[model samples]
Target chain A: MIGVELRLMLRRRRVWLCWVLLCALPTLVAILLATTRLAPPPGRGGAFLSAVVSNGQIFPAAALALVIPIFLPITVAIVAGDTVAGEASAGTLRYLLVRPVGRVRLLWAKLISVAAFVLLAVLFVTLVSYVVGVLAFGFGPDASIGGAGAIPSLSGVELTPLDVVGRTAATVGYLALCMLALGAVGLFFSTLTDSPLAATLGVLAFVVASAALQPLDAAAAIEPYLPTSHWLAWIDLYRDPILWTNLREGVLVQLGYVVIAFGAAWANFSTKDVTT
Target chain B: MIVATSGLTKRFGRVTAVDGVSLQVQEGVRFGLLGPNGSGKTTLVRMLLGLVHATSGSIEVLGEPMPRRARTVLPRVGALVEGPAAWDHLSGRANLRLLDAAGPGRARHRRRRVDAVLEQVGLGGVDRRPVKAYSLGMRQRLGIAAALLREPELLLLDEPTNGLDPRGIQEMRALLTSLNEAGTTVVLSSHLLTEVEALCTHVGVMDRGRLALSSELGALRTPTGRVLVRSPEPDAVVGLLDGQVVDRRGDTLTVRGAEPAALNARLVSGGVRVTGLTEERRTLEQVVLELTGTGNDRVDRRPREAVVPGRSRGAGGPR
Candidate 1:
């Protein structure tokens, strides 16, 4: 049933287009990095691939990862958020509900498809980061420390190529978790509203409001607990000493967000009178 | 019973859309739900399908409590509620294929079924065209095809003849008749009384959220013995009968107050010549309209009840 739902989502032209464009962003940026010499440090043609592959900070892939939470999540929210609302608006939800399927099963199929899309979006960012990062910076080893020295990094650790891949894979895995949670937020909002636009905007509003609230000095005490504040915690994966303490907490917090969103979605969707 | 509802009511905010309406549909019967605009026919249908919540009363479909979980009943029923049912971006065939894929029906055989229904609905050659490009009539046909994809045991169609040309209406009428003949129970709601009279075996007339009348098509029709008598001696007939007259035209009069013996005896005794006396009676349209107040002014003011039938289709389908 989930596979069937996923097939339907993939068949949607708008959703497919959004997925493809986001997937190609990193690849496009990598190509540009390889052609241009404006890359800082480790100068010259040889450094091009090395710099490009490891260029998560300046390349389009990294830019997307950063910019996506601000914009893409809203788009992601729209896709995930409109999953149910869009059907209602199109007058298709009633048709679907009349099928020989339970509401729980139907909702599950939809959620799974949305989760798949969210993973694809995260994988899009991760793959671009890996491809361009390796091509521009060389697979020599990700030695650069990200932000504070919390998690371990390959830059100064002198690890093997495979080890670096393993570490990056783990890091990408955590990032996927955070992204999936955001997608769930969109799903929850989608279940609440009958209008596709309202569902899409509602999810974005929650994320944007959280982002806005994170920097408020007056509410600094509660800022750490905000869902948006922990989005960047994936960077902790590239630290020198590997601070597992805060990293584990970030994962838990992300999971907590997923639980709340999905819980709300299920409760409301189960009872929401599908007027359409 | 294929479908049954008792005191089914739905209220949106403060307005009672459907109020205390009870209805029943027997198996293999083409039941027509008739009513004027805002009479809550659509709302009742929606609640029966579990598509909308009923504010009060209980509805049982296929011998099971409705809306408790529609899964058991949904598989046995197919419906097309107002307008074309399709994704505008998809081809007509693709829309059929999608619906076909969702149910227990086999996807491999779906193509053949899709084609058959399209052909039946007069949309055979345009399956490749995007649904958005189809004309209103074509779209309506496509919607019917989509609804028929599963070949369910029961079909609920709301004004399936809207936008159909003369030939299309004839075809649709034939198609519905054939479906009923094949043991597929049909419940259709239409404003065209003539259409219902032509196809449906049973009908339930609604008046402002209430079931005003429900009976077999044959029973609701006018008696077979009445005669339509037109004469140029209206005043003379009125004076001669002394109260047996039903209606007086410009110079004509309809007399249903006497049997053949009494009518002929009185006419002979009065020395009045009868020019024409046709035995044909009223139409279901006349009966429905008169009963529903659409034909109140024109209705025969005698003791017999006015059988109103014709009402806007909006009162029955999705509002």
Candidate 2:
């Protein structure tokens, strides 16, 4: 049933085109980042891509975070938002449901499809960013110890290229999990609303609102727990001795969200009348 | 019986969509569910297919409880509900192929069945065209093709004639008849009385979430011997024989309590001629309308009503 669902979803022009964009967008951005080298003013090259510096962790992370609220979430939103509503609106849902496939199988198939799209989008962004970042700045690991900090030269790290790539891939995997949570939340919203715009915007609003609160001094107490706050925990990958606490908490929160979102979506979708 | 529902009931909040309706579809029976709009026909079909949960009562398809084990039963059933709603972006063939893959099958069997059903439904020519480009009638045919792909033991069709041209309806009727002859039980819903009259062996009429009438079509035919008379001189005939004019539809006359033989005898005797006289065979449409209580608007008022030339209102009036 899932195989059929996946095949049907992939056949849609919107889904397929979005997937192509997901694969290409990051690569295009990477090319721009690498080729359009805007040198930092004076001694600013020493500063890592942090939030405060013109070209640092903050710049790239903010860009990536912005992409999260927009770019990456669209893939999640398209797949998730289309899951039930698309079927209902098209009338194919009745046909599919009348087949041997159970509601559970249908929901799982959609969840898996959304999960696959999330992974594809994240990998696209990571590969393009890594290749472009390395090409522009050199193929070495840079360190941004904290927010607004300097990105140390890669010449000092003792790790082999293999170790660095392996660590970077692992970090990418963690980030993918965070994005997967967004996909699940988007799916939950899709089940609640029949309009794709509503579902997509609903998920984006949640992510953007959380990100908006992170920098506020008064919301400092809740900032650490926000999906947006932990979104950049991947920066810990550059730390000489990576701290697993933030990564662990991020993974836990993401997992919790995925479980809850997916559970809600499943529960709502299974019992949904699907009148459309 | 292939499918049976006992006291099936479904309610949405305060409104009941299907209210304690019992239905039985026997093996190889071509059952027609007839009703006006909002008569709960679709809701009942949904319940039988386990798409909508019944609020109260039992439903068994092929002797198994519905919904609880609907997956097991679904493999043996096929349905085309409302219309053929497919992924408009996909080619018509791809849509059929995708639906075909939902059931258990091998690659070759799936392809063969898809091709066979497409051909059967007369969509063989437009297999590669995007579904969005197909006409409404063609889309309905494609939906039937998708439904018939598996050759299931039971088939459920909802408004299958809708959007179909006359030729398409005839083809569909013949196709369903043959499928039933080959041992597949079918449950179809349609507002088109002609389609049901020409195809179904049994009919069920529903009104306001309740079954108003259910029986063999043969039983609904008005009793024989009552002749339908159409004459411009209805007054002369009425005055000569004092025959009760049951109803007047344009120049036609429905005279009850009178035999054609007696009416003919009295007309000749009184020198009042009748232009046309034919035996009235009640159409399924008339029976359905009257059974559903939507025929009350039909004015049967005429002073020359009740009483016939040869037969009185007492014993064997017409038949």
Candidate 3:
């Protein structure tokens, strides 16, 4: 059943369109940065945009920063929100249920498929930006004090290229988890309504509301619990000593959301009458 | 019994879709569930397939408790509820392949089974066009093909012939009849009276969420205790039968209280030429209409009393 679900997701043109559009944004940003050679001031623009002008190897991290705020979440919400409600509106949910596919089993397959999309989208953005970054700005000169072929960390400490690769990989994993937390929320909303558009909007509203409240002093008490609050914590991986404080808190918070949201989804779906 | 439901009922908030429908369907019989629009036929079919949970009752299919053992029982029972539905972007064949793979079926014979069912449903010559491009009749056939993918022991179809043309309807009737002949119990819900009368062996009529009548097709069409006689000399036959003649139309006379054979002998002995004589049996239309009430779709306003200036009380008026 998982295999079938994956096949169905892979065959959709809309999924591929999402991947193309996601890659397009960062590539466009890389071109403008390459041709014009104007980098956002340090500590002002995206997490690593200013650094990418000197070392293209860090562009993948910069690209992650570019999309993490908006592009990635929108695509994830669209896919995850469409999971069950899309099937219900298309009139296939009842057929699948009667096909002897247990409701719990179906939900499991859908979640796994949504997880796969998140991993692939993050990986594709990381990979495509790496190639674009290298072509637009060749590898930086070996000028760092740490060693030859090393890049500078956000903490003013020099790091080797191999270390850069390892940090980027960690960043990818962290961002994927964060997006999955959002996906789980989307899944819960998907089970609540039969319109895929409605569920997708519901997830978007949730993210926008969370992001909106994160900055207010009055909301500071609940800020730590918001799902979007920890999304940028992956940038901590680039620190010289690797700030584990926010990263650890981020993992726990995202894991909590996944569990609670998926639990709610299952509770509502298992007993659904499937009138459609 | 292939299917038995006791006090099966389902309510959607304030609306009672199915009300205490204790239906029984025997094996190897083509059971036609006759009803009007909004008569709860689709809801009942959905419950039988375990798609809709009963509000308070029990359902048993293939002698196993439904929804509880649905994983085991459902594979042996195929169903098509409401109208046909498939992924609009995928071809009919692709849709079938995906649906077949979702259930517990032999992976080795997946392609073979899909092809065979498509052929059985008369889509053998279909091309690779997406389902969105297929005609309504083609989609209907594809829906049936999906149901037949497992060679189920019992087939439950709701409005199975819904979008088919005249010839397509004929072909479907033939296919269902052949499948039933091979020992598969067939149950179909339809609003078309002629469709049921032509295809079904047993009948159950539903009205306003209640099962009004259920019996063998033959039992419901019992003789009406009258014999119809057609002769060249209609007056001679009427004169010979005297007061037994209940109705006269052209060259035929409806005579009560006599069998065809006895009536024929009497007419011939009385020097009357009897061209045709046969006992009258009730038509299915008459039987269904008699058992059921006005269809739920109809809404009539309250009748108003007549106001006349000079007419006294007890005067005749439209009731």
- Is candidate 1 or 3 superior in lDDT? 3
How high is the TM-score of chain B in model 2?
0.82
- Tell me the TM-score of each prediction against the true structure: 0.82, 0.84, 0.93
- By DockQ rank, best first, the candidates go 3, 2, 1
Candidate 3 C-alpha lDDT tens digits along B1-319: 9999999899999989899999999999999999888889999999898888899999999999988999899999888899888988899999999998888867888988899999999999888999999999999999999989899999999999999999999999999999999998999999999999999999999988888888999999999999999999999987888899999999988999998888888899999988888899999999988887776788765445445679654757545
TM-score of chain A of each: 0.81, 0.78, 0.97
Candidate 3 error regions (>4 Å): A143-148, B235-258, B301-319
The Cα error of candidate 3 at residue A202, in Å, is 0.8
Candidate 3 residue lDDT tens string, A125-242: 9999998987787677765554335678999898888898899999889999999999999999999999999999999999999999999999999999999999999988999999
Candidate 1 wrong stretches, greater than 4 Å: A24-36, A39-64, A128-155, B105-108, B223-226, B230-276, B279-282, B290-319
Better by DockQ, candidate 3 or 1: 3
Every model's DockQ, to 2 decimals?
A: 0.42, 0.54, 0.65
When superposed on Cα atoms, how far off is each prediction in RMSD? 8.4, 10.1, 4.8
Q: Summarize candidate 2's per-residue lDDT along B210-288 as a digit string, tens digits.
A: 8888788898896654678878787776676564777778767788778887877877788776789887887887788
Q: After superposition, how far is residue A71 of candidate 3 from its true place, in Å?
A: 1.5
Give the CA lDDT, 0 to 100, for residue B159 in model 3. Answer: 91
Q: In angstroms, how far off is A13's CA in candidate 2?
A: 3.1
Model 2 residue pairs with clashes: A48-A56, A48-A151, A49-A56, A49-A57, A49-A58, A50-A56, A50-A57, A50-A58, A51-A58, B244-B306
Q: Judge candidate 3 at residue A13 and give its lDDT.
A: 92
